[model samples]
Target: MHPKTSSALRKVDAISKLLIHTQRLLDGPYRSKLSVSTDLESSLSSCKDQLDYLLRKLEVDFTQQPNGKGRRRDKLLRPFKISSHDLKWPFTKTEAEDIIRRLITAQELINRALQVDQINVVLSVEQKANLEKLPVANGAIFNSFEDEGEPECLPGTRTDLLRDLNTWIADPKETRIFWLCGMAGTGKSTISKALARKLS
Candidate 1:
């Protein structure tokens, strides 16, 4: 009924909501590899208990007081005072804010750690060296086609040819010899290389 009691109850609700949301984040979204550390989880549980106790004390002390203007409410609020000093509501509010801030900071740190771990994937020295090298080869027949850019298939150049070749190769009903007949420089070698790449 009193403003102070209402404010404290609101703060308690906020804190509870924050804790629930944080628990969901830790349990659901970050459940796999980015879970919160066990120590943090324990500390959060303790904070939750402390907040629950404070809320219950506030409810019992304020709501059960006899209807009196001045002395009775102060007397009821005295026994369960939040702090030794005068400020009651601010202390709990500040504490809840601090807890939420710490939880958010911990979440950010865990996300950053996950990003770093993903970036630093394990690779052998040979694999690393292979990644660094240019992905090109210069074999005998392919060397002749070096002038036509790297031996990768040019896009949209040989659709019908590739389809026919694929059909011939996949003809399990009969053994067949495929002949790709085209004049020189009509991209015969290029088609062959592309087909080889597709088959491989």
Candidate 2:
């Protein structure tokens, strides 16, 4: 075969493989193993085009930015301002179902992390907000735990704990207890003191 013909044949093969993979991506697993599909991959673009068609049919938007932030930032894709409006919504039902999936994923991740015990982690502002948004039942009573005695709180740490505690209280979840666990000398006692002052 001619050299040029060989190269062209290779491109065709690549495109053919891409089409088959992309069809699978659209059918069941939207969670792409690949980071991002390039525009040159016509199959990927075609799948997205199908997403756009379904979005238009429903009129909810496939890539509408929930907060007018250009595009709803995908979990893995950060610092990308690419508009989802042109990208596609995939399905309306998937949006809600994906939220539940993400929540379960995160909860499992947290539990798995806690199993290690030595690894301490902090939730990002957005993660914390989403966790707080988890629904609660009606008539759920919130009982604030109180420790009787002089608080052992230190300096301005009281201020920080007060802020966090106030937020926990403001939340409407059916939280029976706030497990403020930490190692010794990690200021758990200090925070307990601060909570006492705020409660008092």
Q: All candidates' TM-scores? A: 0.33, 0.23
lDDT of 1 by residue, 1-200 (tens): 55666765676676677667656755775444333332357656865776766676664533433456335556655888732234344336676556546545555544555455345433344558876795665563443554456455579877988988888888856555677787887877778878876876
Cα error, candidate 1, residue 14 (Å):
0.9
Give me the candidate number with maximum lDDT.
1
The RMSD of every model to the true structure, in order and in angstroms, is: 15.0, 22.2
Deviation from native of the Cα of residue 77 in model 1, angstroms: 17
Q: Residue 192 deviation, candidate 1, in Å?
A: 32
Q: Candidate 2 lDDT, tens digit per residue, 126-186?
A: 5678778989643322233343443466666557667877888778683856788889987
Output the worst ten-in-a-row residue range by lDDT, candidate 2: 31-40
